[model samples]
Target chain A: MNTIDHHWQRFTLRQKLSRYAVYLVLVLAFFQSIQSVEVIPEFLLDAPEQMGDMFSRMWPIDFAYYPVAVHDAMIETLNIATLGTLITLIFAIPLALMNASNIVNSAWCHWISRFFLVSSRSVNSLVWALLFVSIFGPGVIAGVLAIAFRSIGFVGKLLGEAIEEVNMGSIEALKATGASWMSILLKGYWPQVLPAFFSIVLFRWDINVRESAVLGLVGAGGIGVVLDDSMNLFQWDRVAMSLLAIFIIVILAEIVVVNIRKRLI
Target chain B: MAGIKSVQNRENPFKHNWFISAIWLLVVCYVLYTFNAMDLSWGRINEGFGHASNLLGRMIPPNFSRWSLLLSGLIESLEIAVISSICGIFISLFLGLFAARNMMPSWVSTPVRALIALCRTFHPVIIAILFVKSVGFGALAGILTLIVASIGFIAKLFAEAIEEISLKQVEAIRATGAGFASIILFSVMPQVFARFIGFSTYQLDSNLRNSTMVGIVGAGGLGGTLFSAFQRFDYDFVAAILIVIIALIMFGEFLSNIVRRIFR
Candidate 1:
């Protein structure tokens, strides 16, 4: 079914060499521009010390604000993540299937799906959060939407890849039984790839949890809102307390996700 | 071959399935619809672009008046990046190894693996903001943010590298009287060290890029200046700051390549 030709190897070598040359040219162009550019503002000598003093002054955090508001805000951050992940999951599953190379059974479908996934992933989530904040008027909803949108890109890409790795033999067998494409996918492909799909989803959920925490800085609500306010107010101690809560929540969430993942695998 | 042909025949088997095409078309349309609903109009985009261009124009001949300020901020950012990378690489080395299922017990590996996941859960900016808030704005917060980010990224890569290694050599080492530590040093390290180096260098490059951003959240570095520039609508200064950040990232990328080559 396959032919090993010497010419093919030569062609691949030529391709690799061209790629290397392009990389070299790009690097050279970048450096050339950098060298010519004027050094602006000039580097500060005592900036580090100033930064250090700022940090040292804020030492020994104030923990008295622990009763209800801070705790509730922390919970809201977690909820934002959970809701965002859930929404992305609903959107991603169908999108992933459409993108799945083997499942889609169409070259145009595959290429277009690939284009969408790649473009979505090219930008970082923070950029999306900023854009959403401007449009949605800075609230939990904006943060949730940003997280959900970003997670869709992440989950869709992984799930599509997972679908491609499924044992296609069963799919063929199902098709041979005169089953429809939908049935073959449901009965054959879904069960095999379900484990990996769920794992990726849960893993992304953990990531979204962390992301939602910071969405508030851009006005996408959560603990970040409080953190931002404290910073603006120059309340270093309050800032310290907020950070402690974030660290604790992240660590706790990490433990829970790890336990769940361990049990699943 | 005949059975395969029959299976293929039953499905639409068109080079482009109509259903998938419709789905994509619908998605694109939905995106467009959302844009319209959100009022992300051409006028707003045009106005933003106009402001951006004017800012870029002003950024030319960057103000060398604040040379000392710029220089010190650059130095602190570089330090924060380097220190965090060192801390991150150190933690990643041990955590990655311990988390590798093939290299360690389920009980031992699971916790370490979980820690890595937790480390990776947050964006560096969010984490930096947290640290700035918690630790009180400065290089320390920036460093902590980057260190956590590096650990998250490198540990995952390291664990995967370890998992992918040949078990035969590990087993051979185990058969010998070498202790677990020695076995890891000889067998596991040899196979994964190069990948670990690659990951470390990449993490360093990433940390450098991120260090500039942490300052935006008041964690330290040039970002604070940049953010203030943005707030003041000092487009020229903002442009100057952005150019410097870009240059820093490019330099980091170059340095990482050199490090990778040296290790290789």
Candidate 2:
């Protein structure tokens, strides 16, 4: 038994050492971060009590402010999402076409479009909102533009993939018929990708609805502005109301998108 | 005759459905009305172009004068992301198992699903605010907030992945009279392990992006530095921070790609 164990240990020595080394590094990093952040065990012990107190304050939401403050903001949020999705579709369609390897034969165009998609997607919508707020000044326009810019990558990437996955048989048939490039694209590729494109756009719209709600935190303008204001003023009841509204709207958007996608597919 | 009759019965492909058209019309009207109410006029838009150009001019020559401040914040953000992702992934593994309807009873899965849904309802920024208020501001709050966000996201995906796994292997393991833990270890995990790795890497990427933003609410990270710089109208500094953030995110994207490749 001792000889067998020794042989096994010798055989797996390198693999075991490398695995342990990786885990050791991760553990060290975790502890270092905890120390740097000064996370006190005593504070963690008291966290539940503090959270309970906060929840107690938030009970019985001030629904009275709903019509006055939240209603308009909710509408603005919806508009931002809808318009943003519309704008995203407008830009994403052409960009997706360019990015689709099957459609765009030019390697440079595909790479350029892919770069745009990746860079756009890499930055969070909040950052985009911040940039737009600086330029457009705090309003729904900034919110709309932020949502649009952030969603372009998501919409474009999905649509491009869908286009790439299109049936080549139909495309070749169109080509054999000596169809014009415009006709082949419109009659061949478009039909195949339309369902997926619509579904992707609707799904993005659902996400944008949730995202646009928070863009107002950076003064991009939406329901999040109301949320930020309530929090700053320590109006827990009003904050609760806004949160409730956001939750309901997000769930509703999800349901709507799911239904639409079901129909489209 | 049947093919000809089928062709004759087909509707004109170019004609739009009435129901869809009506929906489109209503949407258009709502958009127009919303635009009017928001006062998004062309004049306002034109004014924004000038502001954009002016801001762009100041943003040139990105400032790295506060290199130490930037470096510390970036490191802290990275730490928060990695720590939260590890913790979140660990917790989510169990939560996902409990929430998998195929593996668990409805009574168990229902409550777990509801908990996950509640976790997911609010944005991370809101959760970070709540954590900051309760726990006091710092990386701790940021970490807690992101852990919640990660669980909310990946747990659901993980549950779905588990549900979609083939039960044959599980049944075979059970037929051998293996204990629950052993059966799960031998059967359940292997099938979903690859997808779990994919989800974990994706969560890590998302957490990295979010860690930067949570600092805006004073939960601790580069966002705080960036926010203060913006408030001080330090556009050059802001530009530098933005550049660093973009680079960090791209690096994360690249890392996730490599991780996925390895798993594949």
Highest lDDT among the candidates is held by which one?
2
lDDT of 1 by residue, A175-262 (tens): 9889997778767887788679768978898878777887778677788888788778887777778878988888788788889889
Per-prediction DockQ = 0.09, 0.53
User: What DockQ score does model 2 reach against the true complex?
Assistant: 0.53
Tell me chain A's TM-score in each of the predictions: 0.82, 0.88
Clash number for candidate 1: 12
Candidate 1 segments whose C-alpha is farther than 4 A from its true place: A1-60, B1-123, B126-148, B155-188, B197-215, B218-264
For model 1 chain B, where is the 10-residue window of minimal lDDT? B5-14
Q: Which consecutive 10 residues in model 2 chain A have the weakest lDDT in total?
A: A6-15
Give a tens-digit lDDT track for model 2, residues A11-30: 25665565466557668977
